[model samples]
Each structure stands twice: as C-alpha cells, then as structure tokens.
Target: MGHEYAFDWLDQMVHELDPQRTEPERLDNYQSIAIVEKAASEKKRLILLFKQFVFREQKTRQIRNSVNHYLSAAVSLMKIANNNLNQIPTKANNFRLALESVFSCLSEVSAFIVNRYRSHVDRDISLNLVNITPDAHDLRTLGNRDAMKSNLKLSKLVTEAFSDIFSDHRGGEITMRKLDYWVSVSHAVTYPNGLLEMTTPFEQLELIMIERNFNSPLFVKYLVSKFSEGIANSEDPSSRVQALTFLQKTFNQIPVMKDIIFNNQFEDLTLTINSWFIQEINFHSERSGTVFSDLGEQTQKASKKYERKTSDKVLCNLTVDQLSIFFKAADLSNIISARSLSAIFQSVAPYLSTPHRTDISHSSLRVKSYSVEERDKSLLIDIMTRLTEQIRDL
Candidate 1:
C-alpha cells in the first residue's frame, strides 16, 4: 500500500505540469506563473535604474571635461591677445571670438549639467558657471555695442587678471611688461572710439614716465616726441594749453628733456612768434598804437605811489591792448600764439620789470613807445628772453 501511494504522488506531480489539467490544478499553476512574471518585471525595472545611473555618471564626466577644455581655451586666447601687442585689434577680436565660442560651449555644457542633475550639483558651482555667461556677452558687445557698464566690467576683469600675473616676483617683470604693452595697445584700439575713449597713448605714457622712475635717456626722448605729437594734433586751444601746462609741470621731473625746452637752436618756438609780431605791427599800426598807449597809461598809473590805491580799486581794468594783444596777436603774428605764452608772461611781468614812469627821461627809458604790433613784439621778445634766462639758471 505504501509503494502504491508513492507512485500516485509522483503521477499527480507530473499531471499538474500538463496544460489540460483539472480546474483546481490549473488555478494553482496559473497563480505560480503570475508570481514568476512579477519577479521578472521587478528584475527588469532594477536593470533600467542601474543603466540610467551609469549614463548620468558618464554625462557628468563629459561635461566636466568640456568645461575644463573651454576654460583653458579662453585663458589661452587672452594670453595670445596680450602677447601680440602691436596687433592688438586683430588679436583682441580673435580672442573675443574664441572666448565667445568657449562661453557658448560652456553654457551648453553647464545647462546640460544643471538640467540633468539639478539636485546633485553644488549651488556655488552653478553660480560660477553662470558668471562666465555674462562675461561672454560683454566680450561680444565690446566694440560693436555701446554698453559702458559692460565694457568697464570687462576691462576690470582683464586688468585684475593681468595684475595677478604681473604682481608676482619670479618672471613677473616680464609678464608685467607684456601686460603694460598690451594695455597700451588695447587702449589705443578700443578706447579710441568708445565711451571709455582716452587721450593718445602718449598721455598715459607720460604718466608712466613719472610713476615708474624710468629715467632713461631713450624714454625721455620718447616722451618728448609723444608730447610734441600731442601738441601738434590737439586742435582745441584749451587742450593745447593744458598739454603744455602739464609738460611744464612735469618738466623738472625729466632732467634729460630740459634741452628740448631750453635749447635755443632746437626749439626756436619763441622766435617763431616774435617774427610773426614784427609783421603784425607793420600791418595794424594805428590800432596797435592805441592799444599799446592804453597799456602804457595803465602801467604808468599803477606805478604812481599816489595812484596805486585808485588803480587797485579798478576792476575789469585790462587795457584795450591787453585784450587786443591776445585776439589780434595771432593775426599780427603769422604763427598761433600759445595762449599759455600770453598768460604766463602777463603773470610774471609785474614782478620782473619796474612799473613805467612818465617822469623818466625818454633816453633813459628802456621801454620804447611803439605801435601795438611793435609793443607786442617787444613784450614777447622780452618775456621769452627772461624765460630763457631762467631756464639757463635752472
């Protein structure tokens, strides 16, 4: 009976495997298959999750690599732009284009990283990523666009980066010199037209000459040449006056440049004006005489001990010749009289010469009565001669 039971059990297990089983047996078999299907579905879901994680890791690596590559390219472009000082315009434009490309690529990569893993990346890293975006925009709009704030910010960045490279001690001087050249060239290129426009590179060079203690003979020669060019190109009288004033103030700072201003042969600038005055005196004799006579009267009055107090009280008291001297001096003199020359002479003459005296014998008088043009010529010659003497004493 035991052997018969064992055979029946074995036969029953085999019967359950058949598709055409009884209803109760079929229900049990179907339940088992459903469980197996559920387990397989769970396994497939887990495999998908693992694949997504791997893809994300790979993408992150790619983005980081791209960011590094673009950063390097941007830095390299800036260096290349700086190195080619003479060709700054072309090189700077190329650098700007290259920087734009880097920025675009970086933006795309950063956006990808931000969108793909917004929760995973650090906030600071994301912010830094965004910072480069505006920098790109600024570089793009530098010359083509009229944006002052953006250009200034860009300039600050460039200057700061340069300062870092230049402020070091080891091989830093070379780097600093390179940066200085680059700054000069870049200023020449960009600032010539924009809101940040500056005077010629020589103006800044003059400042550098003062600041850097660059007391070389060649440097002074270069500075003088630049000053001369500035004076030549300056169309505005005020600007020319300002240039000469600055030149005068900085004159003592440059020992080597003293000859350029003081030496008679090289700089017969005063003679040029005097020759002009001689011609003008002959042309406007009556007008010149009246103006000079008024000046003489004023001088004579101002000199009198009794009239000094009254003369001091008079305001708007310039002699007609005093005013005419400036306006007509240019017409009388063929060369343009530097307004500075007129102003300085007027200021210095009172202390240098004795006040005119009517009681003095005409023969003893060093002052000669002459036409307006002649008086102007005499005044210019006397003033320049005194100045030349002073320069010699210095």
Candidate 2:
C-alpha cells in the first residue's frame, strides 16, 4: 500500500513536467534523476555520489516547484512515521511495507542532482576522473566554465558528510585537498573492484529512512526495534548501553517528537517508568495490606500478587482528587517508591499541575528528570533494580 502510494506520487511528479512543452534542460534533468534512482536501487554508494552532485548543482540553485516534488514527498512520509511509532502496524508488517516508498522516492530525488558528470557516476575510477577533470580541448570535457565551482562544492560536501569516518589534515587543522583527489576517491570506492563500501545494518536502514520522507513516530519505533537485535546479540553490557545511547540520539533527531520530548525533559518517560512503579506499588501495597484497612490479617496471610484490575485502571485514569490522595498517602522510604511517586505525579500533573508537583516534592522524595540520555538510563536502571529487590516477596 505504501509503495503504491509512493509510485503514484512519482508518476504525478513525472506528469507534472509537460513532456511536449518541457524545455531540454528541465526534461534532461528529470530523466537523469529517474535513471540515477533506478541504478541506486542496487548500490548505496550512489547515494553518497548523489549528495555530492546535489550540493554542486545548488551553487547557482534551481528553485522549481516540479524539482522539489521528490524532496517534498520523501520528507512528508518521514514525518508521518516519526510522529508516532506505536500507531504504525508493526505486528502485521504494515510499517515495513510503507517504508518501501521511502527508498524509491529518495532514489528519484538523487537523480535530480545536476552535475556535469551525472551520466557517468557508475563508471570506473579512471573514466570518472577523466570525466570529472575534463580537458578544455576535448569535446566530452566540462569546458572548465563551472569546473572550479563544482569541484569546490564536491570537496566541501564530502568533507562535511564523512568528517567522522574520513578526513584530510594539514598542520593539525582540517582543510580542503586538490579537487581531483575528492572526485577520484569518491569515484574509486563505488567502482565494482574499488574499495568495498561496507555499511552497518543501522547505516543501511538509515539510507532508506530519509528524514524528509520517514519522520513519523512509527519509524522511530521501527528504528528502536531494529537496534534491539544488536543489543540482544551482544553479551557485553557496555555494548547494550551503546545500543540504547544510539537509539536515544536517533530518537532525538525525529522532528515530530523532538520539541515535546526535549522540552519537558521527557515527561513521557516519567509516564513509562511510572506505569511499572505504579504496578509494583499496587502489588506490594495490596499484598502487605500495610496502607489499607484489615492490614494485620492480610499481612499475616500468604500474599498473592494483587489481581484487582479495576483499581489499576482507576490509577492510570486518575482524577485530581484521587491523585492528591495517592500523593498524600505515598510513603517513599525507598528509591523505587520515590520514582513511582514521580511517575504517578507525571501522569496526573498535566491535569492538576502546579500544586501537585509542589506538594508531592515538599516531602523528602526528590523526583528528578535527567535531561541527558546516559544519566536517565543509568538512574532508571538503578531504581528498577532496587525496585525488583524491594518487591521480592510480592
């Protein structure tokens, strides 16, 4: 269904260019985009080359509505996915199906990138280098008119994109190299026999999840789920933590949830932790019967895990009066209880904001929302571990 939608969008984009009336320059660029995309369906290296071309062409930018259609479509689909990962049909493979359009549309966008050597990107290093650095007398050459501009842009684009993976240094400071070096290396690697362009599973997925097209929340969850393979396969705790850190950084990049998540210090995180905290709290409270009537007899009896679902539903859907009572009665001698209180506070604080948090915090319980990913995960792990120990009997 998703791929079909993307194809319809692509057809619409192609039809937008009136074939009979379209000028040679516009028509050629459009056709080139389609061809490049068709090739890119097989090679990831084409994407890197496409980016280089885009930066170069935009130097004296062409700002056409028809030209922007591909970019617009890619970005729109991304937003839909990044906005909410949970809502996407995960179990039924609906989310993965939708993502097919993403790769296809992005490939088309790659084709739109205008550069003198757009046609020969798939050629060998020697041939591409000759094409990139053309002779003035050669009819096939770029004529050197826009050579400097294109070369400079390529230098800038490659350096920026691969700063982490590869870089050139001069006198301890990073600087541009000869133009041929950039074009040569870029072309060399993608050639069938050249340096093997290795990519991680994450990197491969990233290629498909272009920010413009797959920005929805469903995509965010998919990313997390994908990373879980890396996390689970690793026996090392550090590797697992790195996986989570990677997830956190990537999640932060999604536009749909960025502001709200970064703004309130991930108040939603509190809700998540609170669900567990609340569940454990109820389980212990009902079993011990310490905080309820008939407490002595219940505490003496064999404690079964709390089975009453009604109170939990009410706990989740707390009214202002009920929330205030929960906060008032909470005894937070342990960290789990404290975090649980914070989680409960977070859930209902929106409906009954100021006085609740202020009143709850007035007691010795200090509930902090760690803005940093490392700290939040560390603290949550510590609290949850102690929480499990504390609820051993329950």
**Which candidate tops TM-score?**
2
lDDT of 2 by residue, 1-394 (tens): 1122333443443333322333323334445555445434533544454455445444322322222333345444334433323243435233333333333444434333323334322111112101122222121222132322333433333334333222322212111122332344333323222111132333322322221123233333444455555557756544444454444445434323211121122234322322333343345455444453443243334132222233233323332343344353442212123223334454434333232232222122222321224544455456558879989968
Q: After superposition, how far is residue 292 of candidate 1 from its true place, in Å?
A: 23
Over 4 Å off, model 1: 1-173, 176-184, 187-219, 226-243, 246-394
Which residue runs does candidate 2 get wrong by more than 4 Å? 1-13, 16-70, 74-270, 291-394
What is the lDDT for 263 in model 2?
14
The positional error of residue 93 in candidate 2, measured at the CA in angstroms, is 29
- In the range 1-394, model 1's lDDT, one tens digit per residue, is 1122211221232233232333322234445454345434533443343335435445654534433333333333333323332232432343333323333333343344344444343211213222222222222234443322434443444344333333332223222123233344344334443322343332333332233233333344554554566567757544554455454444434323111221111213332322333333323334334344543453345334222332333232233333344334442232443322332233323322223322222112112222355666566667658879999999
How many angstroms is residue 297 displaced in model 2 relative to the true structure, after the best TM-score fit? 24
- Residue 169, candidate 2: how far off, in angstroms? 44
Model 1 lDDT, residue 86, Cα: 28
Candidate maximizing lDDT: 1
Error of 2 at 72 (Å): 2.5
